[model samples]
Target: MTEPTSRSAPADQTQKEGSVVMQLMKHGKEVGVPSNELSSANAAADQKGQPTLEIRKDYMYRSTGRPEKTDMIKSLLTDQDASRNCELYLSASSNCSAVESSEDSEEDMYRDAEEIEREKILLCETSSSEHKVSVAPETDIMEYCRKEWRGSTPVAIRMRKGYEAVAQKFASIRRVRGDNYCALRATLFQALSQTTQLPSWLRSEDFTMLPENLLSKYDWIKQWQLKHRLGRKMGEISDEIKEYLMLLRKKWKNISEIKGPVEKQEACDKLFKNEEEEYSLYEALKFLMLNTAIELYNDDKDGRRVPVFSWLLFARDTSSNPCQLMHNHLNHIGHSGGLEQVEMFLLAYALQHTIQVYRLYKYSTDEFITLYPNDPEEDWPVVTLITEDDRHYNIPVRMCQETVL
Candidate 1:
């Protein structure tokens, strides 16, 4: 194969950099370009007693003496007076040598410019990640288990179940791929492993789907309707959440374009903003879950089957919708939306069973920190916990641990 070659730089300013400028620089304070030849901006600045050149710190102090102006040759050579600027060329270097030198200098400059542009593009991508939900390339589930652990290692969940002991104490990790609602999916699968009321859609072999995808599950949604004490009709709840999925689907295309905190906040607002015709996506889910939890309560008050969504109720008035203030349970982020943690806590609290959270991390040690909600008498209501991560990590589920095919 032919060797890769560098792109040629423009044969102008870049070529002039280390040539005549170097000769003038070597001459120290002697060879001075006429100050009149400076650019008008520089001329105006110089007349007002300002420094003529914005130069490097080392370039500021020359060998001989502190000159009134630095990089004078650079300014003069770059101006329109090209022919007059040739006087500073070194006599030792022939015209042919100078031409060759200029070519190399041009090539080097071009490479530097390319590198800078690459860095700028990378910076833009990094900054824009707030709104862009990145989906990794699809990988086989089997490959996930066989592959050697790289980057962030997956954490096995810790929960006590007499039947299975949470997947034989984390014997395997099944990676969930190709979806935005990963955290929600993972949590639901793990937390609801023992629940007899799990919807068939959740257990289907190919059922990796979001809440919006569940619009057809009438029976599952019925649970939502029966449990909701707010008495919101099931039809209304279904329509609101369907609209949310529609917005998110369209946004998958536009999200890459979103950048900065402001745009991200706007996107989140759009997800939560209810217009004249309908409620925001967030509001829709809030109400849907509201009804579902109510249904669970009515079904079996002693079982504490569903999450305590009444915690979402606001008896007092607020500036905004009371629903927005109930975001304390947890904030969902990842594939689509998530609430397995909040759901688990609500179910556990209702059933009078304690839930333990393992915030696994691979820092100086290969271990996880356990988290428990504070006592009811604390400043906050049920629980107030914050987990910080300085690095990336993985979470494995307890619901159904299967080997890759």
Candidate 2:
């Protein structure tokens, strides 16, 4: 034994080998592996006397420990400064594969274009009320120009024309009622009467009775006709016929009263049960009577004046004071200047009898007081005054006389 070749040499060599294995184990742990598993696997490989070169299976070590080995390999392959220097090579290979696939797909480009064009034509030919027409994506200006030139009407324009025609027809139907023309004339007469401060005599009596034809001939009628044409179109009336009939019947009933006051009052109650509704009838009757009275009062053509007093007496058959009735009629005329004189005359006549009675009473009482004031035992002589020839006369004797005071 060449001095037994120092047993330390083999021991040192074993230690060096173990250190290299530890270094590999440390590297595996650093790259995310269990340190104990890495060490045990390396020790087992060493015990089998396997070539350390075969034991250093980097791929095996990486795959055995990692769930994301493929991802790690991809990352490593993409890195520019990677020790393997395979990033550029892998990138070139992937690029070439993509280019080949693109070329293969390009072979059907013309066919796809033809299919798209067919679809567009099919869509354009189809007409549907439910589905709205829409412009094609990426449409060229020339395509829009061609479509516009074809006179394919827009939905909005067609709808507008249809509505306009309907409106014209509706307007034509409104004229048949004759209310518009009549209302305008009524309004004009009312406005003029109010503004001029003229007596109601100037206004028409029973103005509602004015003929529609007569009202239609007014100047304002022409103005309204120019502004808006009347009447609705044909065929639209049937839908509204029931309502129109009801309105016509109502108007007819109002115009035709064939009943006495009791029957009329009952009818009025049936139609208008509320007191507020009666106000309209009251106002209408008041206007009618006022107009009639004014016309009769102002009429200069007749030689004989219509005595409103006679009318009042006719209305009230019982004994009514003529003076009071005349005064009321003057009040109704509502001319202050003329009313004052009538009022004064009525006032003078009202006090005349009372003044005479008071004067007679005072004279008789004074004479009696002068004759018998101091004598308590003597009975006073009674005095009586009688109206004869518009003068008061005193009676010296008081025999069963009754004084009406």
Best by TM-score: 1
Measured with C-alpha atoms, the lDDT of residue 225 in candidate 1 is: 22
RMSD (Å) per prediction = 28.1, 57.7
Q: For candidate 1, lDDT tens digit of each residue in 90-167?
A: 111112223233334433432345444554575466555522322222233233432322112122111111112323
> Once model 2 is optimally superposed onto the true structure by TM-score, how far is the C-alpha of residue 350 displaced, in angstroms?
29
* Off by more than 4 A, model 1: 1-168, 178-180, 196-235, 238-321, 325-356, 362-405
lDDT, each prediction:
0.30, 0.24
lDDT of 1 at 243: 56
Per-residue error for 209 in candidate 1, Å, reads 25
So what's the TM-score on candidate 2? 0.16
Off by over 4 Å in 2: 1-206, 209-266, 300-302, 308-405
Residue 317 deviation, candidate 2, in Å? 26
